[model samples]
Target: MTHFAPVEPDTATGESADLLTQVKKSLGAVPNMTKGMANSPTLLKSFLALSGAVGSGTLPAAVRERLAISTAQLNGCEYCLSAHTMIGANVAKIDGEELDGARRGESSDAHIAAVLQLSNTIAENAGDVDEADIETALEAGVTEEEIGEVVANLALNVMTNYFNVLARTENEFPVVSL
Candidate 1:
């Protein structure tokens, strides 16, 4: 059961309603996570803004999804793991092996593996990763810009992971558990 019940799009008014409508139009559905977030329009908007900004960053869509999967797994957020697993395969076109690798923070591609390692370290250590972590990623040809974007993407995923966990947001997608 949800600690905070999701705000129905139909019953929502003002900014909440508007934002939920946009989400539905863009994604063709308002996910239960967003529905729960709709209770606070400001929070929902902030999430959207950050998500958009990160989406336009230097990392490729596949890499972003990998980072999300790694972070979600590290954080033990089932909702995020499920959502990103679906998006990673369907939208990002990441193959099954790569998706599974992401869940374990491993990738056959060296650069992607490096980024995933750094992201997992950051999430696990609460952003207190040591210099060696940076060195390893850099050595693997992970660009500085890619590193920065990794942090941004990690932040975005962490926000969603924490929120969904807190709200106990009912999973609408195929359930995935740690």
Candidate 2:
């Protein structure tokens, strides 16, 4: 293992404890990925900030979730798949077939489907997304900036997914669907 525990819970009296508390409070538990981030409080903070910045963007949450799952799928990141499955279901509140379809690598909605197609292509082709794919995503109510965000989300997840593999970050829960 990468010794992620030392950073997960620091024996400190100030900011580190507060950061852990903030993550725990927000998530009701600190996930191993975040714990790994806690390795460098700066990374934890930057990730949080990046997460917040990405979340605040105008991209539809559902499309973002779909795009995220699709990228995780391509990366073959079991940890990312496990992490994003919940966001797709619970946080995005997409249900049933839509949720299952996502894991099954299906796009649940028209716009999301389009985004998923593009994301999958990007993942499959090693980030060399076709020009026509970009055109289709644009026609699907996804702005150019949103497309950039999609790419960013994919890149960000790849980093975490690989980290989880190296760190063997503890899986906090077992959801069979993941």
Candidate 3:
């Protein structure tokens, strides 16, 4: 494991402390990824801002969580997978089967499956998908607005996935497997 210890909420200072405090207030605890991100206050702030904006988009919470899980799995970030699995179950009400399916970039729901396909493509291809790829998503009932949000959500998840993988961040949430 990398020596990047998570910044403890109690000992954190400046912008990091304030951010960690807010995280605790919102989630009732500080997730380790956020703590690790706190090592760079600007990165933490940017992530929080992007998360809030993307989270407020038209995409359903379940779909967002599914995108997050699928992207994380594609990036091979175990910390993100574990954290998002808990959030998917507790907050999004995603069932075990759906959670498992998301990790594989599959979903029984057609809409979710479409979004996941786009999201996975964005993650794996680094947002370099061709026009036909987007047309396929549009044909599946994904609106342009929804596609935009999907791209944002995929980017956001990828940021965290890369961060955790690089930082070797500890998992504060329940452990989940691919």
Candidate 2, residues 76-148: lDDT per residue as tens digits?
A: 6667777777777777887757756665557647777776777677767888877888888888877778777
Q: Can you give the TM-score per candidate against the true fold?
A: 0.96, 0.81, 0.94
Off by over 4 Å in 1: none
Q: Which ranges in model 3 have alpha carbons more than 4 Å from their true place? A: none
- In the range 56-143, model 1's lDDT, one tens digit per residue, is 9889999999999898898889999999999999999999999999999999999999999998888788889899999998999999
* Pairs of colliding residues, candidate 1: none
Candidate lDDT scores, in order, read: 0.91, 0.70, 0.88
Point to the candidate with the largest lDDT: 1
Better lDDT candidate (1, 3): 1
Q: Choose 1 or 2, whichever is better by TM-score.
A: 1
lDDT of 3 by residue, 75-108 (tens): 8898889988898999899999999999988999
Cα displacement (angstroms), candidate 2, residue 79, comes to 2.2
